[model samples]
Target: MTSHPAAEAFGATLTPGTRPTVLAVDLMRAYFDPASPLNLPDDGCLHSAARVLEAARAHDVPVVHTRVSYGPGGLDGGVFFRKVPALAQLVGDSPMGELMPEVAPRGDEVVVVKQYASAFFGTTLATTLHARGIDTVVVVGVSTSGCIRATVVDAIQHGFVPLVVEDAVGDRAPEPHWANLHDLRTKYAEVVDEPTAITYLEGTS
Candidate 1:
């Protein structure tokens, strides 16, 4: 709702549906570990996402998580792998591809392995959500300008309402983080904080 030109021009906002699901996108070691080349700025985003996960579990909401991985030599990944050399470290048997313990998926949760930014790109995410009767997707995870943004867009395109938890999504730089959040809030999804998302998940909103 800022006075930005784009926000004023389009001003589209997606409202969350009653049957909501939690989607933790790409909360993996490579983005959380400091030693990894893909490490993000800090762990604040992870902590916020963990809180949302706790709320989701408490409410017995369908929780889905995504991790990016590739087969040996990244043959499964075409141009994407070649464009980002750092992605080579995530292929086959690499610890970097594993989801971080902070926001790990539970036994009954769905874990979608994808090579691209959108969870719905080459996966059965949309179909699975449809089968589960899920209408709203409460999203949290790393790199807001990347997978988070892509997932939000795809979620809306696939006919699911996307609600992005602002504090739970981070980026390599603050500028892109803030910028993408603004754009997402203005158009694609409903950008919210962790508390707002949890309230909605609990059906109190």
Candidate 2:
């Protein structure tokens, strides 16, 4: 673990466990489709996440993916869907809910669907990882200020080291995105670059 003056001051630094798993959260087509409100103009983050996933799979690392969908009329989404009408595109079998082809989950790799921001909320993510003896969660995917932040916070609370790939998560605007990343780096998780994350995954046994 490299020493950071801020981390030293805050007394918050993380040591990633030997058993690391890739948790690619919300890598959906909605963020890539031009007509979709969720579409991000610059999708470099998606490409970065794709590379991270490739490295994790090549190194035999366990992988888990997440997608958000609500029941018809978003009854399952509760207040969140009503708050963000864009969620309508992800209802049921809408093509917008499809996993992005680049980082799509393959056979046998676990995929969890949820209605909320945090992957662990009302989901079996924590239990599932604990069952497999997974101790570190390497996170990559969209909207750094939302789902990614929520997942990392919960991962730390659930006793999993959260290693967020800084280059592999994005938001509609840079302000909230960078602000949340800085906070996560200092308080919740180790926000590292994509290459750093990939190297770590490759080095893990």
Candidate 3:
């Protein structure tokens, strides 16, 4: 059998302590809003992501959710906030900024609110995962060309193996999605479909 490069690189030596955790990032209202310039309605990754979430739950893998929200008046948001001025409205109680119901935060599960593309940048996500004994991350969510890609890169940088679920992530446009996924598959993380990922997680679990 032909070995997948990423599976050869990282999947071969997974240990019992290195439990896989699922991170559903930025599947929020702002991404789906028609008025938002960053909207990616045609990217039907959310439904696939929901399926991943269900599978993760069934397999007992820890689930974490992330949303990009600025603090009051976007005080915590720096230069990046200025570039996307509209993102400032996501702070506090803005309805347009909340995580969509289908992938909403559940009781006791970790929810990370980030201000930048990398979920681990200036966030408690890394610490939380480390404390939970999570060494591998199954990353799913919106805008494959943006935050999802950034998080996958950072996850690898932090010494955690990141597995990108192919159909479980979306982007505003097709070109960037294809380009980023290509780059990720070669460099940052292993890119696999939901079924393969579920099987891998199950085997490792």
Off by over 4 Å in 3: 1-18
Q: Please, what is the TM-score per model?
A: 0.94, 0.95, 0.88
Worst 10 residues of 2 by lDDT: 2-11
lDDT of 2 by residue, 133-194 (tens): 99999999888999999999999999999999989999988998999999999889998998
The better candidate by lDDT, 1 or 2, is 2
In model 2, residue pairs whose N, Cα or C atoms come closer than 3 Å (at least 3 residues apart or on different chains), thus clashing, are: none
**Top TM-score hit:** 2
lDDT of 1: 0.90
The pairs that clash in candidate 3 are none
Tell me the lDDT of model 2 at 3. Answer: 67
Poorly placed runs, candidate 1 (over 4 Å): 1-8
- Cα deviation of 4, candidate 2, in Å: 16
Q: Give the whole-model CA lDDT for all candidates, comma-separated.
A: 0.90, 0.91, 0.83
